[model samples]
Target: MRWIAILPVLALAACAAPEAPGSERVPAARAIERPFDVSTNVDFILVDKSDRTLTLFRKGTPVRAYRGVAFGDAPTGHKRFQGDERTPEGRYRIEYGNPQSAFHLSLKISYPNAEDRAYAAKHGLSPGGDIFIHGQPNGSPEGQKIASHWTDGCIALSDAEIEELWQTVPDGTPIEIRP
Candidate 1:
């Protein structure tokens, strides 16, 4: 009879089981507006490495700017080779969306364009790829402390911020990264 009585408690406990492996864990929810209501369209994205600001523009006007973005751990100069721990500089595009990214959600950056490839070839190095604007990694407390640089070679935004970016920005959007 005691075992039977414990069944209900076990069932309730299952509701709080640990997150599964490969789960896309996002931070707390925030109030974000719909894309259409926010603006007609996104014209371009500008990332200033010196200021660590990612701004969205529409028709040459600044629509929104996400501040306190984290960068690669070794963000000193242009990324030359794979594992450089530096964000690449130049023009790129949001190539795709990853709904199951390790970092909550991510917008893929089309790094290693022709120029990047050529430059790498000249130096006999591999231009690292898989760059993205991503949210904080799942199960990481570091998400809350994003003022400091802490990426492998990608732009890191808070979970709430990335959610807004994911909904507002579209693929093929041109992004200019500068030093």
Candidate 2:
């Protein structure tokens, strides 16, 4: 008799909706159109500030591209100091991943390279750090959209795109940003 009573509760629990992974807050909109293929090897990344695109390359050949990417509020010129609101230009590397970020997900960019540091040092300004490629702000409601260039200095992508990148891009991948 007890077994029969417990079965209905188990069935009810099973019918409940499952939670989305990676974060406690979920978006109201469907972000991912398709899943990423993890087998593809991504060795390089390129960001074109003018075009607002981020492209992934496999062994020098373009493999994947994300369009309508967002950048800093200023969005012009190379980032020289903290709070400049400009994305850095030149070569850098993907240093690590942040699954618990305020954004949906993120990949840290190695900014403030030697040249960047030198310039900031010479000018007595702090070269901003903690630059990353990230998704929309966590808990964003469905249909809410951010501006084209809204970040303080980091690059922004769609939640789905960043999820794909979080799976595909590995640490130490070279990245080049162009004006």
**lDDT of every predicted structure (CA atoms):** 0.79, 0.83
Candidate 1 ranges beyond 4 A from true positions: 1-40, 141-143
Top candidate when judged by lDDT against the true structure = 2
Q: After superposition, how far is residue 31 of candidate 1 from its true place, in Å?
A: 17
Q: So what's the TM-score on candidate 2?
A: 0.77
Candidate 2 lDDT over residue span 1-179, tens digit each: 89999999999999988854311221211323354466775898878887777877676656677778899999999999999999999889999999999998999999989999999999999998999999999999753558579998999998877887988899999888878
lDDT of residue 172 for candidate 1 = 93
RMSD of each: 18.1, 19.0
- Against the true structure, what is each candidate's TM-score? 0.75, 0.77
lDDT of 1 at 166: 82
**Candidate 1 displacement at residue 84 in angstroms:** 0.8
Tell me the tens digit of each residue's lDDT in model 1 across 1-179: 89999999999999987954323222221212224334355768778787777877676656677767789999878888899999998778999899989987999999989988899999999998999999988876854746789898899988887886787788999988877
| Count of steric clashes across candidates, in order | 0, 0
